[model samples]
Each structure stands twice: as C-alpha cells, then as structure tokens.
Target chain A: MIARLLSAFALAGFSPLLWADALTGDVQRQPLNVSAIAMFVAFVALTLGITYWASKRNTSTSAFYTAGGSITGFQNGLAIAGDYMSAASFLGISALVFTSGYDGLIYSIGFLVGWPIILFLIAERLRNLGKYTFADVASYRLGQTQIRTLSACGSLVVVAFYLIAQMVGAGKLIELLFGLDYHVAVVLVGILMVLYVLFGGMLATTWVQIIKAVLLLSGASFMAIMVLKHVNFDISTLFSEAIKVHPKGEAIMSPGGLVKDPISAFSLGLALMFGTAGLPHILMRFFTVSDAKEARKSVFYATGFIGYFYILTFIIGFGAILLVSTNPDFKDATGALLGGNNMAAVHLANAVGGSVFLGFISAVAFATILAVVSGLTLAGASAVSHDLYASVFRKGRVNDKDEMRVSKITTVALGILAIGLGILFEKQNIAFMVGLAFSIAASCNFPVLLLSMYWKNLTTRGAMIGGWLGLITAVVLMVLGPTIWVQILGHEKAIYPYEYPALFSILIAFAGIWFFSVTDKSKAAAGERALFFPQFVRSQTGLGSSGATAH
Target chain B: MHDLAYKRIEQSPQFKELVAKREKFAWILSAIMLGLYVVFILLIAFQPQLLGARISPDSSVTWGIPMGVGLIVSAFVLTGIYVQRANGEFDRLNQAILDEVKQ
Candidate 1:
C-alpha cells in the first residue's frame, strides 16, 4: 500500500527510505494480463461520465472553487480518504513489508497521527475563514500581495514535487497494469487529470475522489478478509505465518532500527504531523462545505476512514509477507519479485482470489492515482489564479468568471509541467521527494498559517520573510542532505546529515516571524496588529463569514 | 446583525466559558497524543528491544504489534472522544451561548 501510496506517492509517499523494492531488481515487467487493462478502461469511462455530468451543473467560480459548498460531511470524508489512500499506501507499504517487515507499520502510524491534530486545531477555523485556497486564510488581514505571492510559491512548489512523484508512480502502475509505455502512461495521467479539473472543476474532482475512496477501501477490505480466511481469521496465525515465510524470521516483527537516532525520528515525525495540516490540497477541502460544523464533521469522518485504512494496510502488508513471499507464480526466474516487490499487494490479490481480483485491485490503484493528481492540479491552479492572479495582480477584484477562466489555463500549464518533470525524474529516487514536499509544507506553510490564526502581532513583512526563509532553508537542506546530497548528487559526505529538516526550518520560520513582527514600529504593522481581533473573532465563531454565494 | 452577535458573544460569560473549556480540552488531547507518540518514537530510537520483546513466553507476536495497533487504535479512540464531545457537550454549550446572544 505504501509503495502504491507513500512512495506509490510514488506521489503518496516519495519516501525512498521505506521503499526497498523501488530500489532494484526487475524494474519493469512484461505487462499485467488483459483483464486488468479492460477494468482500467471501464474506471476511466466512469470518471469521464462524471466529468460530463458535473461540467454542466457547475458554471460559476463558487462551483469551480468549492462545489457550491454543499457537499455533505460523510461524502467529503470519503473524498478525503480517497484523496489520501493513494497508490503509495497500497503498493509501497506492502512492498516494504515484503522486504523489511515491521518497518512498514511505523510508517503507517506516523502518516495517521496527524489527523486528530488537524481536527482539533485547524479544520473548523479554516472552514470559517477561507473562501477558496488556504492562501485566503493567510492573506485575510495581512499584506495581500506579499502573503499571496509567498503562499503561491509555497503551494506551487509542494504541488509540483508531489505531482511529479505521483505521475511517476502512475507511469509505473500503468505499465504494470495495462501494458502501456511509461511516457504514454504519464501523458495519459496528465491529460486525464487536466480534463477532470478544467471541465468538471471541484464538483467532479470531489465525486471522483469519493468513488475512488470507496473502491480503495472495499478492495483493501476484500483482500484483508481473503488473507485472513487463509489462517482461519486469526491475526496471530497470520503474523506467525508471515514470520515463518520471511527470511528475517522474528526480527521482522519489531522496529528494524529505521529510527536510529532521536533527531532524525523527531524531524520525520514533525514533517508528517504538521505537513498534512500545511498541504494545500488537503486544506482546500474545507471550503467545499457550508459551515464550520460541517467542516469539523468532515474531519471526524476523515479521521475514522484514514485511521481504518492505515490499519488495513498493516493487515495487507503482513498478508503480503505471508502470501506473496510463499507463492511461486508471482516470483521471477531469479526468485525475486516479477515487477518489483511494490507489486506485492497486487500480486497478493491474484494469489488470494485470482486474475479477476487482480484486475479489480489494479483498476483501484489506477483510480487512486487519478483522484490524487486531480486534487493536486486543482490546488495548484488555485494558487496560480486565486492567489497569484486574482488576489495579487487584480487585488481580489477579478470577477468570478475571469478567475475561473484563469484557473483553467493554469491547470493545463501545470499539467504539462508535471508530465515533463515526471519523465525527467523517472530514473531518480523519488521516495525522498514526498518527504521533501512534507518538510517544506511543515516549515513554510504550516507556521505562517498557524501564526496568522493565533498571533496578534503577526505583520505581513514578518510572515513573508519568515515563510520565504522557511522555504529556502527546507530546500537548501534537502538539496545538501544525505538523500540528495550524498546519494543523488554523488557527494562523498552530506553537508546536512538528516533526511528531514522540519525541526530546524520550523524554528527559523517562527523566529523570523517573531523577530520582524515584534520589532516593527510602522503604522502598517500596527494596523495589521489591530486587524487580528476581527479576524480572530471571525475565525473562532464564523461571525460575518461569507456564504458560498455561488448560485 | 453579525457584528452585534460577535460583540454579544464576546462579552457573555457563557461564551467565555465555552471558549476556555474547548481550547483547554483540545490542547490537553493534543498534548497527550504528542506524549504517546514521542514515547513510542523514543523507545524505538533508544530501546527497540522493548518494542521487539515478545508479548509472552511462547507467542511469536512481539510487543510492537500491540503497541503499533494500540497507537493506531489510540488515534481512532481519541478522535471518537473529540467527536463525542463536539457533538454533545461542546455543541450544547455553543448553542446556548449563541442563543443567549440572539436573545
């Protein structure tokens, strides 16, 4: 699942640290048997049908930006879950377990722990404040031009890196599932994602996500149930069987020294915990609801779905260890996995239920990639149009029609950029790419957004300077760190020792924000400070908040 | 109407109490979760053997399985607690505060 989700991040997780199968052996396979391709085509047809239906019904900026703010809590929850349980979670985690064992379990838990915090601290307040992009929240009372510029840069950067990773993952998955060329698969993903956003907008995107989420959860449940049935439905039997088949035996059941030191572990934890809160794609979901209460409810349901899904990944991972490792048909001539071990979960579907189930899981994985990329595209386009164009260039005076038109243009541009980068990064280790995205999100966006909500003295200059610093620090450290520095760039030793830099970069942001804001004696700073009261009240209680105003 | 509502809610003791209580509860839950996760991570970094230790003398199941499961379950339970409080106690308090202001 992680292979398919995290490193399947391959946009969901670009974490190379966890992806052993992603590293070596059979990098490509001949193809999935024919049933998989047929099922995938059917899934695409269904999404295109949804796009055609949604395009007519949604005609205004409000519809394009937020689906008229009418999505129900349960549906949004499903969409959020769909948005999250990417191909990375399905393939990556299973592959990790297939190779390393219990290490996959720790990764899954870290990914989940962020949700309760989002529910408690940010979700309701965000729903109350933002109109479309999360940048709407940050620039509410600050220097609109400066803040939006910084936020657009931050959002675009995160989305670009993440989109590339997902596209690459999509390429790999399509090649395995549909017998397509890698470049063709990437272009197909890019073009389809653009069509979803350009035509159907948020309404289509949300429904696609909802459908994908349902399919993914049901597929995971079917696989887990099938896996358990083999062991008489006893978890102990499953784990023991996995241990016996695994070469590492009992050692696979514990932490395999991945969190070797406190600093690295703490930094990684900070990235995962705060990164989700900062992710532009995730934050923009709040605006698709009517009120703060609905937003809060969305989080509640999302927490349940996401938490449940992670637990399923653990079951599926251990199941792969037990089932996939022992099966000869899934193995290669050299006894290695046929299409890389990241195919473990997909292969397990065939092992448990045969080719038909394999076809089903493969389709679900393809759907997962489509749903996530569409979400990313919408968020990126909003940062370009709503934040950069409407808010900054036109000073929020751009009409609804004009803004939506610009967003569509931005979507096509972003889609092209994503395809190009996907091809370039194909040979690169993308596992750390997701981690880099999270680090910037945690450092740059999270701090600025949180402080804007809570701190009274937060000035525009402070936020811009601090945010850019955070952004630069994260990028510089990422480039010089062990992953990119030593491994990717072929340096002998890393200038930055750790893989994650959120801990240091977050402090830099806070310090820059605090130092500049507190020292400012200018009239604008005082005015900005005064504006925080009304902003605070509105954020807390939704007093005088804008309605969707779409229809 | 909205400005008047904000002024009234800001002044009312009920609103004050609600805000304080909600904020305090949220921070506490967050703190507890952070503590639990930090402890787990610390154990992994400092004493992996503890998580590696078997659940019992005979079982192949290690302590990490339950601990990992427990952490996952802990997130679900904590979310459930938050939802229950939000839907029941917090909502009731919030409604009363708003109603008082509306009157």
Candidate 2:
C-alpha cells in the first residue's frame, strides 16, 4: 500500500494517485449513473440508522473514544481490516500491477508485513496499558504534560496529513464515480464522517467499517473469480495471458526500477513497517477490545483478513491486466484506459459482471473512503480531547462530560478543516502527503510510544526533544526530497536526495532519546524509571487495566 | 490497591515466568517476521534478477510472485501462532498471577 505512493509519485503530475480515478485535474461531469448513486444512498441510510442507535450509549468518554471496550475480537478484526484496505490499496495496487506486475506485489507485501509486526511487538501491551489515545501509555509514568503534549502534536500532524490525502482522494474519486462536483463530493464526505463520529462515536464507526470491509472483500473476490474463470481457473494460464498482453511483456515479471538504490528501498521499507505500528487510528483499535487476549486475537484476525485482501488485490490486478487492458471497449481513443489506470479494477468489474456490479464496486469505493476518514477524524479528536485537553491542560482532573464535549467540538472543527483543505489541495499533487504522514509516524510517534512501553530510561526530556527532532526532520527532509523539491516545487534537483527519510530520522530519534535519557540525572527521570516496574507488571498481566463496561 | 497488586505480582515467580516466556515468544516471532521482510526487501534492492528468475524456467510466474505471496501467508500464520499461545497458555499464567496478587 505504501508502495502505491511510489507509483503515485511517478504518476503525480497528470494522473492523480491512490484512490483517484480521474484522468486529469479537470473534473468533467459524466452522465450520472443512477445505480451507483442508489447503492451509495442505501449505504448512507443504513449507517445513519446505526448511528442513531449508537447515540444513546455514547454518554461516557470511554464509549465515545472506544465503544466502551465492548467490541469483540472478530468484529474488531473486520473493522481494522476495513480501516486498512482503503480504496487506494484496492485500485492503486491493481493499477500498478495492471501496468507493472511484480512491483505491485512488493508494495502489497510491505503493507501486509506491518500487521504481523504490530501483533508480535505492540498489540497486547498497547491494549493493556492505554485507555483512550496512545498518549495514555506514553504518559503513564512520565511527565504527563510534556509527554501528552508531544504525543498530541505527533498524532495531530500525522492525522492532518493523512486526512488531507484521503480527503483529496475522496473528492477526486467521488467526482469521477458519481459525476458530482469535486467540492460537493469533498463536503459530502466531510459532513457524513463528522456525523458518524459526533453521534455514533466508535460503535457506529466500527459497524460502518465492518459493513464496508465485507462489501469490498466480496466485490473483489467476485471479480477475481470471474477473471480466473476466463482462464479456466488455471493461474499459470492467467499469468501467461497477462504477460503476453502486457506492454512491458516479461519486464513486468521483475522489478521495474521502482527503487533504483538500496537506501531508498530500505527507507521506504522502514517507513511502511514501523509506520503501521505508529498509526493513531490503527493503534486506537486495540482499546476497543475487552482485554489483552481479545486484543491479541484482534491482530490475529486482522492480519488474516488484510493478507487475504491483498492476495485478492494481486489476483484482481493480474486479472485486470489480462482482461481489461486488451479490451477495446474499456480503452479510450489514445489506448489508455478510460478515466485512468486507477480505473483498471473498475473497468474489470464491468467487463466481468455488468453495469450493476460496476455500480456496486463504485459505491463500495465511496464507502471505503467514508469509513476511513471517519476513523481518522475520531483519532484526531481523541488526540485533542483525551490527550491534550483532559491530560495536559486539565491535569487529569476534568470530568468525563467536559472531556467528551471537547471531543465533539474538536470533531466538528476537524471536519470543517478537512473539507477546506480537501478543496484547497484539489489540484496540488498529494502523493507525498500520505508518505509524509507515514514518515512522521515512523520517525516521531513510533519511537516515542515504543520506547515508553519497552525502555525504562525514557525520560520526558529525551522523548520530548527526540520526538520533535524526528517529526521536524521527517517533514523538512520530505520537503527537500525528490518528491516535493523537484516534482512539486519545480526545482532542478533535490537537496535531500532520498524520497523516503524514515531511515535517517528514525535512527536520529532512537539515538537522541537514548543519549538524552542516559545523560539526564534529574529527580524526575529517577521517578519515571522507578515507576517502570509497576507499569511493566500491569502491562504484562492486565492487573489494573480498564475492563469492558457492564450493561 | 493497584500499586500493591502490581508490587505483589512483580515479586511473584508466576509473573516472572509469564513475562519471560511471553517475551521470548514475542521477540523470536518478531525477529522471524522482520528477518524475512528484510531479506525480501534486500533481494528487491540488491538482486532483482534473482527474484525475477522463473521457478521452473517453463512457468510464467517468477519466483518473486510466490515469495511475495509466501511472505504474506507466513505473516498470517505467525500471528495465528502467537495468538494461539498467548490466548491459551500465557493468558492462563497471567490470570493465575493476578489471582495470587489479589490473595
């Protein structure tokens, strides 16, 4: 999925990347597809019904932030898969494979590898130690103000970049799918996501995600089956046909210069792996389950579902290459697929099924964006309310009512902010935005959160300075790197040569935190180190962790 | 009450055993996952041609495709293995430790 950003940057100028199916920046209105619109309306109606039911139970901060820890592991697994298998991964990887075959596999592998790492390293401890946001765990025994403030900042920055990327993609994808104005589509997503988080909170959002994940997986599975059926269910025949028809021929079977150097490849790998572990929304999923056992199960199921989904994407991509690319009806006058390469899966849906299946797939794409953005908004709101307002400003003394109120207000504000930024960045190339989000997450948030749970010597001074160092380094280096400096800013050459900066910045964060922490002899550092054992005991055994709310 | 519970569990052998066993399992699994990933990425970086080589020379699919798919499958299986142990054995140990601490 992160490797989708690699081709996204390459396809940055004329073809919008990830979820966008539009061929160009010009958003032309096509004949309105009544079936797509009808399915979308049905999805909206059903989710709103669930939201109405969820409102009654969302009285406590716990309910608002994590559905009162009431979610089962299986359900949480589906929701986590939903949060991850974005429309971008579905269409973008397929498009990548439809064009350059094996590289897409590499990208999907990068995306799936992160889930297992999260399961083995982070998931159980996170569920046991944290309450609302990850800041809860980071600030457990450290200086509550400094650590919480740093975490909130890191979370917000990642959230802002990620939201903007999703928003822009949603606007463009909806514009092409439903034939709506770009601004209208962006505003529609903004309003619906805000409604989901503001009223339904985590319970409503979870159900919405589950529904979308099921729809997406089923739709993709059907398409893949149809593709295999065309080749008599022989995978070798399917591959042979794809290799024969693909323009790149045998070259598509190997790496196609996606990363020219070892450094860039390793940097990108580091970002995708650790970035998934650091994501606020993904990490927040652990708290929705009842305990560490359910949390572990959640990762187990999530890894399976996500890996299955990626395998399906690979089949669908090769299927698209074999079926859709050669079909004259699916191509434009210029021989390019109508709309863009990202429409490979969409056209394949129509080629395999019909107009009706096409409508279903289109609607599922819109639903995927909505589900994803709602989760991001909730994570962002939690950063502001639970982490910053409750823990930092109120010093953990605020009533739950006040904290929940702040969360709702922050949700509305974030919705408006997302809508505005979506429209503002409509024409700008946003491939780097998601990459920047991942970089900051891997470099800044992952290091601090990981160290706090595992390391006894992670003092506030070390975490604060090192965390900001990584955050700023990731951003500045991104701007000075190839993607932005040369491509976006019209520069001759990049000052920072690498496109991905996680390799450098993550090391700096770890070393900086280690050096600062070991050098510090402050009384505060001693107190924090002294508290690590109790934290360790609870994290290991769930001794005093929050349990699921009783009915 | 909570601090006392933590202190009691911290001193107990059951807690130590739980931590040691779980930590070992977790680290070993993490290393395998990360090691496999690093090897895959390094192959992509250093030896693209080797990964591009056909599995049987007559097959249309290259070695990279199965290796990639294999990595994905292995990831799922590894998590399954971890969850199976953690939820069954380690979890029982954890609960027993908690009970002793409560006593």
Candidate 3:
C-alpha cells in the first residue's frame, strides 16, 4: 500500500512534466516539467479573470483604488492576510526555520504582533481620515501640497525597495522551477505583474491577495498536519528526537546557542519587530475598509488567521530539518550545501509527500510572489499618480481618466524596473532586502503618521523636516552600515558593525520631528487645534457623564 | 433638540470616567509592550535556551514557533484592550465630536 501510494503520488506530480515533454525538444534540459507549466497557466487564468471582473465593476477612481469603499470587514480582513503573506511569509519563513530552528519563529512573531498595534491605534484613525493613500490622514491638518510631497517620497522609497526584493525572489524561483535564465524569468514575471495591476488596479490586487493567501495557508496547514501524523501526533517526542540528532552539546530549547554573538541576535530581533509596523505596503490595506469598526474587526480576524499560519510554519520548518538530515541527495557532490537555503521547504515537501505536494507548494510560492508584486506595483502607482502628480505637480487638475492612466503607466514602469533589479540582485539574501525596505518605511513614513494622529501642535515644517531627515538618515546609515558597506561590497574594515539600520533610523526620525516642531514658526490654527484635540478628551478622562457630547 | 443635546453634554460625567479608564489602560498596555520587547531582546541575548526543546531529530529548538506564539499573544492582548476601549468609550465620544463639527 505504501509503494502504491508513493507511485500514485509520483504519477500525479510528474504529470505536468509529461505534458511539457511533448511540446519541446529541450524539455529534458528545462528545470520545470509540464506540471509546473500547467499550474502557472492555471494561476494566470484565475488572476486575469479576477482582473476582468474587477475592471468591469470599476466605474470610478474610488472603485479602482478602494473597491468602492464598500468591502465587508471579513473580506477586507482576508485581503489583509493576502497582502501581508507574501513569498516572504511562505518561502522565507520556512527557509529561516529550516536553517535557524527556533530563531526563525522569532521573525513570524514580530510580524504577527504588529497587527494588533495597527488594529488598536492606526487602523480606525487611518480609515476615518484617509481616502486612498495614508497621506490623506497626515495632510488633513497640514496643507495638501506639503504632505503629498513628503508622502510621495516616503512611498516611493518603500515601494521600490519592496519591489526589488520580490522581483529578485521571483526570478530565482523561476530559474529553479523552470530551468529558465534568471533574466528571462525576471522579465516574464515583470510583464505579467504589470498587466495584472494596470488592468485591474486595487480590485485585481485584492482578489489576487485573497486567492494566494488561501492557497498558501491551506498548503502550509496540510503539510504541517501530514508532518505531525508521521510522528503519531506526539510533539514532545518530536522535540526530544530533534535534540538527540544535533551534534552540538547545546540544549535545543535555548536561544543563545543558535548564534555565535549576542549583539547580532538582539539586532535581528529589533529588525523583525519594528520592521513589521513600518512596512507601507502592509499599512495601505487599512484604508480599503469602509469604517473604523470594520477596520478593527478585519484586523481581529487577520490576527487570528495569521497567528495559526505561523504555527504551521514552525512544523514545516522542523519537518525540513529532519527530512534533509536523512536525505543524502540534499547535499552537493563536494558534500557541501546545495540548492541554497531558500529551497529547504521545497526539498522537505519532496521528501515527505513525494512530488505532488512538492509541485503544489512550488506553485503556491510562485503565486505568493505574483500577489505581493501586484500590491507593491499598485502602491508605487498611487505614490506617483495620486500624491505626486495630482496633489503636487498638477495641483488636482488631472481628471479621473487621466489619473487612472498615469497610475497604469507607473505600474508598468515599476514592473519593468523591478524585473531588472531582481535579475541583478538574484544572488543576494532576500531577507536583507526586505529588512532594508522596512527600515526605510519605518524611518520615513511611520513617524509622520503617528504624530499626525496624536499630536495637536505638529507643524507642516516639522513633518517635512522629519520625513526628509528620516529618509536621509536611513539611506545614509544603510549605505555605511555593515550589511551593505562591508558584507555586500566585501570591505574588510567597515565603519559600522551592526547589520540592521531600523533602530537608528527610527530614533533619528523621532528626534528630527521633535527638534523641528519646537523650532518652527508655524502655530496650530484654531480649527486645526480642534481637529487635533477632539472633544473626546473629557470622555477619555473618565470623569464625564455618558452622553453624545464630551465637553 | 439642540438644547437637549447641549444639556446632556453639560450634565454627563461618564465621559470623563471613561476617558480616564481608557488612558490608564493605554499606559498599562504601552508599558507591557515595552517590557515584553525588552524581554524579547534579553532572551535573545542571554537566554536563547528559554524557548523550548527541539522538534526535529537534530538538537536545535525551533525559535520561530516560540517567537511567533509570543507575537500572536501580544497582538491578541493589545487588540482586546483596544476593542474594549473603542467600543465602550471612543465610539460615543467620536460621534459627539462629529456632531459638534457638523453644527
């Protein structure tokens, strides 16, 4: 029965390869067989179908950007999961777990924790004040032109960094799965992503995210269950077995043993935790819901779903560690590591469930990349079309159709740029790129959003100075920091030794905002003061009666 | 109706109490988060072994599970506090503000 089951699985898995074999003479040379191609085609069709339906419904700019601002709390919540769970969540987290063990789970935790912060402090306010971009909220009291310019700059930096990271991962995955050249894969992904975003906008992006989220979560859940079944559902025994296999005498339960130094570990933790709230692409999802209540509920649901998914990742990662240790083929001819760290999850799937699960997981990972890239593209488009063009350059003269066209064009341009960068940076660590993006976003954008909502005396000059200062500080620190200056460029004696730049950038931004606010001449206007410090103050004090008005 | 609205606003003392409670909770939550973050760093530095035993045949304990669990728990706690406050207090006060602004 075992043999038959294995054989049946192999047949199901290899069927795609069999189909590909009939099309080309070079099929044997290609990395991807017929099955991967079939899967890719199917995903493309589904994505395009979504785009078509969304386009048909998109009669106005609001529909194109915010789905007519009528999406249910549940749907928006699911879409948030879709937006956040990129290739990084699926492949990146799994790979981290495979290599680092317990340390990998730390990244997942940092990411999941940020949602509550958003839910509590940012989500409702973001929905209530903003229409499309977060700039809407920040600029409500400040002048439009000032906030628009600052937000555009911040948005562009974040979107570009994120886009490059996704593209690089996509290119590498395509090369591994299809035997295509890295450049070709990058270009192919670029074209498809651009088409999806340009035609459909937010509507297409939302649906893509939802679909990918479902696929990824279901696949991870299934694999985790199967893995647990292998050990007869005994988690305690699983851990004990893992401990026995390690050559190192260190206890598997401990944290300090995983790394050689203490500082690196702390820095890594800081990067993961702070980076979660700083990401622009993720924050943009909050504006899609209708009201603050819906936004809050959506976040609640997202937190629960995302939390469970992370648990499953832990299982998958540990499963890989065991499966790879047993499999001889995983190692290279020289007995060194082969196939790179990112492929750990893929190899694990092959070992446990044969090719069927392997192919399915691979397909899901590819879809994950596509969905994230589409969202990033939409963000970039909005930065240019909405904030920079309409609010800044053209001063709101651009009509709806013209504005939409600009957005589409920007998406295509960014898509191409991402493809180019992806091919160039294929050899670099994807996590590093993601970290850099988070650092930039956190430094440049986060402070502005926070202060605008809470601080009544915040001035336009302070915001501009703070935003620019954050941007410059983060870029400069990252350039001179150990990660880029020494490691990437191969400098033996770099100026800074730390790997992550997030903490420093955040501090600089905060300080800049404070300093500028105190020194600037602009004063809070009467109307603005009221908006900044609402009548809710008395209610918050807990000394007032239960009435509609607080004052 | 306007007079009634004004009278109600003038007479109500619950708003003050609610605001005080919400602010107190916010401060507590903020402190807790700060403490947890510090602990997270400390655990990373000096007590990596605090996570749990390994699950694989190898001796390495998977940190991702513990960290992921910590984040999820923190998120839930924070969300719970926010929901309690928002539903209990902010909703009514916020409506009042909107009404005042319109007038």
Each model's lDDT comes to: 0.82, 0.86, 0.66
Under CAPRI classification, how is model 3 graded? acceptable
Reference-based lDDT, residue B57, model 3: 54
2 against 3, candidate with superior DockQ:
2
Deviation of model 2 at A226, angstroms: 0.8
Interface root-mean-square deviation of model 2 in angstroms is: 4.0
Which structure is stronger by lDDT: 1 or 3?
Answer: 1
TM-score for chain B considered on its own, for each of the candidates: 0.96, 0.93, 0.56
Write model 3 residue lDDT over A1-551, tens digit each, in one string: 43333222222111111111001111112365456667767888989998898878766667666766666667777877877776656666776666655555655665665666566556666766677788777776776798889888888888887777778767666667656676877887788888777777777888888888888888888888877887788775565565565443244344423333233334444445555555656666766666676677788778877877878887887787666655678776675335665667777777777777777777787788888888888888888888888888898888988888888778878977887787677666444566667677777788888888778767777788888888888788777877688767888866766555656777788888878876766445444445454322321222222111101
lDDT of 2 by residue, B1-103 (tens): 5998888888988888888999999889989998997777667656779888988866888898888889999999999999999999998888888777667
Which portions of model 3 miss their true places by more than 4 Å? Answer: A1-30, A258-272, A334-338, A424-431, A487-492, A523-531, A534-551, B1-23, B40-71, B77-81, B84-103
Q: How do the predictions measure up, each by TM-score?
A: 0.93, 0.94, 0.83
Better of 1 and 3 by TM-score: 1
Tell me the tens digit of each residue's lDDT in model 1 across A25-120: 225745656787788788889999999999997788788889988787788888887877888777887677677777777777777778888888
Candidate 1 ranges beyond 4 A from true positions:
A1-16, A19-26, A259-265, A486-488, A548-551, B1-5, B99-103
lDDT accuracy of residue A21 in candidate 1:
19
> With candidate 2 superimposed using the best TM-score fit, by how many Å does residue A238's alpha carbon deviate from the native?
0.8
TM-score of chain B of 2: 0.93
Ranked by DockQ, top first = 2, 1, 3
lDDT head-to-head 1 vs 2, winner = 2
